[model samples]
Target: MAADHVDHHEHHPHGLAHQFEDMAQQKESVLLGMWSFLITEVLFFSGYFLTYLVYRTQYPVAFAEGSHELDITMGAFNTVVLILSSLTMAMAVHKSHEGSKNGTLGYLIATFILGGVFLCVKYVEYSAKFEHGLVPGLAWHPHGEHSPQLALFFSLYFGMTGMHALHMIIGAGLLIWLLVKTAKGTYTAEYNAPIEVFGLYWHFVDIVWIFLFPLLYLLGRH
Candidate 1:
């Protein structure tokens, strides 16, 4: 019994939680938890999306006019930046699997920088809207037909984009924490659950932006 216990202890991966039977089980548990959390997130965002669709159907022209007020060029640039961040995030997870600490750190830093860039672009866009007095219920002064409907469009725009930005901000905070852990060599081939789970979250954020870009920036632009 003593020898058997010693063997089992040796086989156990580093960082395995006491409650988990083994590394595989622990990884599965963490991944499932993250997926479950993401499902809730999807539901949360769905409300906004549904509202946008319903309102757009009722006020198509107003929505289009509001979309035109958006800087499509900046929106497109941020989309590309976010897509690149997703790539880097994936690469970081791959490096973690390989136990390449330096590789993981480099990619994670790149992802962080890209995320920052996206947020900065969003700040610029928001600043412009504020300056132009387009914020609904705050400084709304739209210069076109259907002023009231335009306010509705801006309301949805801020609500959706603001929520997206909040998620990005949270992701950025997570990245900073991950970067510190990664730099300290906390993750490795036998225990990279955090990195993998975070990758899923980061990818979800990017996918949200993919939907948002077309809806908020490209809609009715033709």
Candidate 2:
């Protein structure tokens, strides 16, 4: 009977560590985990970048022309949207830490909308490429007597950007999960580790775009 009573007491709400203590441990673990995951992400994307480098070195002119085919305006717009979403995600974390549940939800919703807008822009860009027959490994060719290296460029472009888009989809799913948790009052002024971790992920995605924009759109432009 005493052993059962002890187990019941241990399961009591306050039996858990205090919120701040929990937050500290949670933050440390999450930061470590996020950095570890980011290292893997860098390694994963590096293969695509290396392939692009090899092909571009082999056929500079074709790569240049292929790069020109990309819509800089659309790419720039998506960059802006991603940056804004990062900002909103940061704000969501901040609000969570401040115990402002409604504010957190609002920022999260804003981030989601921005993410949707980014996807819409991406869709338009991809459709244009499709119409131009720029798909990788399928119906891809340079327009109007361009270098065959353009095919290689398109291949890398599709592979890398497609992977990035997949990451964005994952990020969106994570944000939705965070939203659900937020609605459940899982985060509070004293306990918001999940928000911080999600912020790290969102920012990492934004950082990838920072590199991607320069590599895919701006390179060989001037």
- Measured by TM-score, the strongest candidate is 1
Residue 69, candidate 1: alpha-carbon lDDT: 93
Against the true structure, what is each candidate's TM-score?
Answer: 0.94, 0.88
Per-residue lDDT of model 2, residues 1-222, tens digit only: 445432223332321344424445656877798889989988988998888888878888888888799999999999999999999999998999799999999999999889888888888999998988888667766466654667778888888888888888998998899899889887878778778888888898889889989888998998
lDDT of 1 by residue, 1-222 (tens): 455542355565778988888888899999999999999999999999999999999999998998899999999999999999999999999999999999999999999999999999999999999999999988877677789999988999999999999999999999999999999988989899999999999999999999999999999988
Looking at candidate 1, what is the lDDT of residue 207?
Answer: 97
For model 2, the stretches where C-alpha displacement exceeds 4 angstroms are 1-22, 142-146
lDDT of 1 at 146: 89
The local distance difference test score of model 1 is 0.94
